[model samples]
Target: MFFSQLINLKEDDSSMQFIIITHDAEIFDDSSVENIYKFESAPDGTIVSRL
Candidate 1:
């Protein structure tokens, strides 16, 4: 299962851009996502979080 969110950013010149946040590891590691950032979380309990 995966979760995702989209965010909008506005610039001083009134230009708008979009940002995407997701839990997909493959998408994060893909070369096409060179300009994107990735974050990882630690296990909170007995379950280990992947990607």
Candidate 2:
């Protein structure tokens, strides 16, 4: 509910931007998301991926 509200608020206000960090990808199932960054941990360090 809160998550959806955030999206709605962002849509209503063009100047608004939300930064969400979530483990579930279902929230990003919509076409509204322009960019997605995934993080993975390795033995050496952390790796970042753009999907």
TM-score on alpha carbons, each prediction: 0.27, 0.60
lDDT of 2 at 6: 65
Per TM-score, the best of the predicted structures is 2
Off by over 4 Å in 2: 1-14
Candidate 1, poorest ten consecutive residues by summed lDDT: 1-10
Best by the lDDT measure: 2
Taking the tens digit of each residue's C-alpha lDDT, what string does model 2 give over 1-51?
665676675635555556778898788886477788898999999998998
* Candidate 1 residue lDDT tens string, 1-51: 122222133224563344666666566563344355545555763434333
In model 2, the worst 10-residue window by lDDT is: 9-18
Residue 24, candidate 1: how far off, in angstroms? 0.8
